[model samples]
Target: MYARLFPIIAVLAALLAPAAAASDLTVFAAASMREAMERIASGFEEETGTKVVFSFAGTGVLARQIEAGAPADLFVSADADWMDYVTENGSIDAASVRQVASNALVLVGASGAAALELEASKIADFLDDQRMAMADPDTVPAGRYGRTALENLGLWQSVAGRLAPMENVRIALASVARGDTPLGLVYRTDAEIEPNVAVLATFPDTSHPEIRYLAALTEGSGNPAAEPFLDYLTGPDAREILQSLGFVTDKVE
Candidate 1:
């Protein structure tokens, strides 16, 4: 009876060993970083045996979730304001925050749409009577960038009522790709991935505040894997992927 019990105990220990040692990481990231983040996380998982899970949404929404005590190991926001929001609310450690990447805004249209130079005066001509798709200007980073760009170009008042606001930049990109909207405003990196769309023109950097993506480990993150994952994002491997994807990685400090 003792020998039989020992064998059963050994088998149970073997079966549960992997589960007991496994580590998982949960990351909240801006919707724009979804593709690049996933690719980087895949490598991270392979290297460290940590299972990475992501929650991708607009920066504002993700920050709000983090502030409300969401169980996220990391927070990667599209702009500093949202990151600041979570930090101020005691959701993430301010010292852990770092800018990972930067991007430019662009005007996008259907892939086959005529290639025309877009300027403040010609925005209406490009859209004709149709609407311009953009993220919700009231809160989303992409939308705020778009609104500011238009305002800086003196085009906001002309096209204010013609805006078709989506929940996030990805949806705004889709609206243009699917021809649901005549044009869209999105990050240059977003325009690069959508084969069904074409970048009509890039907005000048002066049109709005600098676009930056910030990453941080959340205050509530208890996973030991979180720190390693955060380091991976700022390390060389992730930098290469981010640059290849059209994100301006020079400011990744």
Candidate 2:
């Protein structure tokens, strides 16, 4: 009886050990992607029987961390520039890099804020005294695009004084949503999640650089689980999840 019980327990442990080990994948992603990525990660874990751990922050900040030898299996950057930084530093696999999604910049105003309208002409009048929030253009891609759009529309020079720089796009969006700033330039997905903000207008494609979200595996991860997650990201199910979240799927482009 003791011998039979011992053999059964050994078999059970062997079956469970691999499942337990597979449940630990570390993913570093952009702060603006937190909400959407978390939801997708949960779904991925459920389907693949893997656990996901995430670190979220500005793409530039995350890139620096990766360059400094942070142990991350995967990276999802808010823009291509930071991903390039990682690849240039030999921190990520250049061949594994892929454009996963696209985001649009939008002017978001506080709920019921009448000072700003979507029209180009009204933007100038709206900028006269109202404070506008933005991320630091030097370190944040969304902010850089915001500045470019303003400069292209001839608003940056006139409204530069009223600009309030935040740490990241999500922070800028929060400022407007919370009424700390009357308006902000943020991703359409960011605006969509904030019920307290109204989208004034989406920046025309010609107004600024195209916003591309890129993903890649970090170098030296060597985790067998990492490739599966990457494959899941490019699969049909993940594309559907991205599309549902207002992210433009690669198929659309």
> Which one is best on TM-score?
1
The digit string of per-residue lDDT tens for model 2 on 77-156 reads: 98878898889989999888877788888888978765454454577677667778988777788888888988897777
Model 1: per-residue lDDT, tens digit, 1-253? 6445533543443343333223578888999999999999999989998889887878877776666566788999998888888898898999999989999999899887776564655888888889999998987899998899889988899889999988789999999999899899999999999999998888899999999999999998889999898899999999999999999888788
lDDT of 1 at 225: 93
Candidate 2 deviation (Cα RMSD): 12.5
Residue 134's C-alpha lDDT in candidate 2?
87
lDDT of 2 at 11: 41
Worst ten in a row by lDDT for model 2 = 13-22
Residue 51 of model 1, lDDT score:
86
Model 2 segments more than 4 A misplaced? 1-23, 114-121, 251-253
Model 1 steric clash pairs: none
lDDT, candidate 2, at 70: 66
Number of clashing residue pairs, candidate 2: 1
